[model samples]
Target: MSPPARARPLSKAAFSPTFSKLKTSIYTDSLRPSAPVSSAHFIRTLSWNAPGTLIATGAADRTLRIWNPEKTNVKNSTELRGHTGGVERVAFHPVNETELASCSSDGMVRFWDVRSKAVVGEVKVGGEPFTLAWTPDGSEIVAGRKDNNLIPISRSTLTTITEHHQPVQTNQCVFTWDGSAIFLTNGDGCVKILRYPSFEHFYTLNAHTSSCYALSISPSGGYLAIGGGDALVSLWDTQEWMCVRTLDKIEGPVKSVDFSFDGSYVVGGSDEDNKLHIAHTETGEYVYTIDTIHPAAYVAWHPCRYVLAYSAEAQGLKIRSTMDVQAPLNPSTLFSVRGLLVVITGGGTSIGLAIASALHQNGASKIYLLGRRIATLEKAVETLKSSSSAPHYVDVLINNAGVIGPRNGIELHESESISQLRGAMLKDWSGWESTMAINTQSVFGVSAAFLPLLEAENIRRHWQGSKVTGYGNARHHSASALEKIGTDADDSRLAHIITVASIASYIRRCAAGLVDNASKGAAAHIGNMLSTLLAEWGIRSNVGRPWNENNIGGLILFLVGNGGTYISGTVQVSDGGRLGVFPSMY
Candidate 1:
């Protein structure tokens, strides 16, 4: 190469003439590689020690790797291999950095000593182990298997203590703070609470309609974080075993969820986009999104560090530092009630209009006013439209509307009496048929037609904000935080359903003179039953107070407001103290 042709060196005084350019190049080459490769290897499952200095990861390649990120060596430091199949979950002993537990698809859970790379013990679960959790005291390990059951194993003996029948593919499980109970979710979309050692079924929460894929419990065990295949993450009250709220509106199934050590932030992994969403625990508002291409199968937060680790199919494992992102703005308050189309079977009565109007004033965004007179419906619609700011939200239908029947006594009407009274009763029954057509049949028909709209509104409200809690001029907060979290309009953002059955339905045999007694007894029974059912869905149902009771409207308003959130399924006997005097108590 002609001795590399002596290089020209016309540099300034600052160039350091004593150092040759070729000599500098050789020095740089010696210090740095031309194409440097990453020293970090792919990870699958990750767990950090209490001090966060030691990290453990289970790999898809059937090996347990212990790493000290602080060390520069590529060596795993320790490799454990008792599992023949891929290891899916790993949990470190709370007090021992040298020991950890791992679950694999081979239907086995293994305890490993990291320092010695030895299998300490193992337990055989009947099905593939999908999720594993260590008790707060580290005395036991709870593993959720492919079969919808949770197997609890003693940490020392590696023996099964108890198993729960969950009915769906068990995806995740967590123990309560005191270690008295365990909560588990399965692919069947059900969450169950069981007493720890006895495994007695305490409560079964049927909130989600799809697979519940991930779960996290608050450090205090007051709330549970659940993410499902339905693209919704729900916050459940551990005490009440009811769903308190849902987080982000995701397009994909949620795979894993974890709460920040402080319980202020909730992080979850989604299957749809392989992205992680961080939300505020109090408000369920999105805080930030982690962009990653790998499909994250699981995620766990380091109890002592800012780092979060996730597992991916092709990438194997990855860890990233969570960035602080601004929280979303406080959600808006827009109340909406679904299932508003009610059909009136009997002739048009002022009571029907009053019920519809009351519902409208109580935040029913849509109402189908039904009756027999076209003119009456047109006029009612016009009146409702003019009186309410949300008039366009109302609809009206004319059905067989008329009076109840002739003023004749029941005996006369039932007898073949050829008189005006009999003719009038016949006319009344005709109107009643029309009422049924409009009230009952039309009610069902209208509900079916508007179901999609109702579902859309429900999803919309869920995304808009936390459940509204308070009465008129009352400040709103999450329902659980409120002093009273009822199904009432002023307290909850959940859609409501109101069924206006006649006070006559409760009047036990009206043929006798004891009409008042029969009616009172009937009303009380209906109210109690309805109240119970509505509570199940977080809705409140109030029957009309006794025929002529004062404060009926007030009671209705209250039940549909902040005071009624917890009142459900039971009938609110609108009848006065008369029903209370009955021997039967609901």
Candidate 2:
């Protein structure tokens, strides 16, 4: 493998990448590619244009499709149909931008006006032209014949410039990044490099024992990624032509390979089971695998953007936007609550019970239910323990259990007399103390009982997450501060007190009585304030546990997942849009 001639060393500081459509390699399922943009068919080849404005694909359907990926939904695609047989390859002119050329088993090289979908030029190459490419300068077109010659023709004249003889069973031909050399892949497991214009052989490399299929040069001319019938994508250093790394573990022959625009990532596609692999170029570590995309026959990275376009066994073209936001979906996925030790204060009934069940069903490590009724709590525990997969343990605490006040404490009685109205207000007065006690004052007792456990867990996860994310050694950097303060801050488990509050907390509402609304609202604010007060202890607080039946549990699960750590002082609404409709309590 040759070291890079023009490639710069990777930056020492990690790059914080912004999401650029799905092509940048983000780790969230929220932005995955939808179903294929086109219907099902055998797509032969796909290529993105120079400016990243369009994608061209040739299909076994004997037709060509031009896609405009800028449209988010990609609804406006133009079809060009002049080929009488299966199209083999499509190339957008590197310099001309507006023109594209395609070759087909139909025995012709046709030039196209990308906008009008009209053929501006055509040349009949003898026999079927299987592969085609444009010179980096866009001065000529080169088509590899099914026979033994590479035909280079002038772009302006559409006349043959020269025919370079290649060994029989040649698969494809490509130019180096600087257009300084031409690389040829022969089916006999070798790559031959030759100088341009003079066509003098520079070197012959034994690349693969099996038939070679794809070849791509890094934009920096520093590396080459090649794959063939050998079911591997080998990374070769361009400077020495020595094989630097081999990305194996693929099931079938690799059909295509491409480097990201900046040469940071290598993308490969396998015809076997149609899996696509994205690997970090420097580390040579496989970063992502998108499986079952169908057999991708061709892969092309967008020239100016972080998008990838490919043609599989479908209606021809699939364009994927890549981003750098890659989060693994395992036990530690972004919105997952798996393996969490949880405690719900009101776990025996109502919304509290629902929260408990949501956590139980989704793989919480252990759960401790807290409620005034011991019998009910026991029953709930048995019910939960019966189906849970992970061992149950008492871990975190939630301040979710609460009560409501009289529905009409602040409303006028329908009774005609003033005496009737007086009774309505006075009847609920004695119960008001209990309402406030259970609804707004229970946090002190519940948190006191479980605060230690929560803190312990926080400390454990701090080290655990830190170690897993490559920050283990850095923890010692803060050891001095911890020793000087003589506090548990460094080893504290981020146990949080999660409070469930209704939307009424932020709005002026008396549906459940002014006092009830006021108490609940105070509870919500207290949860947020707790964070600031407990900042030194590493104990955080957040208000708002969404009910699962209402996608609030989904939000609450998110709050408890990895996302929960970053948030501590906000009121996240999980009300199914009911805040706007203002539904009445029955």
Query: Which prediction has the highest lDDT against the true structure?
Result: 2
Stretches of model 1 off by over 4 angstroms after superposition: 1-44, 69-73, 162-165, 322-586
> Considering summed lDDT, which 10 consecutive residues are worst modelled in model 2?
468-477
- Please give the lDDT score for candidate 2: 0.66
Candidate 1 overall Cα lDDT vs. reference? Answer: 0.54
| Candidate 2 residue-wise lDDT, 1-586, digit = tens | 1111111112212222322114422111112355544332466677776666677777666768777775534346777889987888888887566688999888889999978889999988878888886667777778988887888888889988878777567777888644678888888878888887677999987888798888888765667888888888888887898999988867788778888655667787766647677777766776666554567656787764446676556434566674323411234455556667787888897777777888888777677777889999889988888343442233356788777776664454354678887775665687788888887777766666665666565444422122211100111111112223332211222456788887667655456675677778878877877766654455667788463455656767777765454566667776666666764331
Query: In model 2, which runs have C-alpha deviations exceeding 4 angstroms?
Result: 1-40, 72-75, 322-586
Query: 257, model 2: CA deviation in Å?
Result: 0.6
Q: Write the per-residue lDDT of candidate 1 for residues 262-293, one digit (tens) a residue.
A: 35457777756667776666666665566667
Backbone clash count for every predicted candidate, in the order shown? 40, 32
- After superposition of all CA atoms, the RMSD between model 2 and the true structure is 18.1
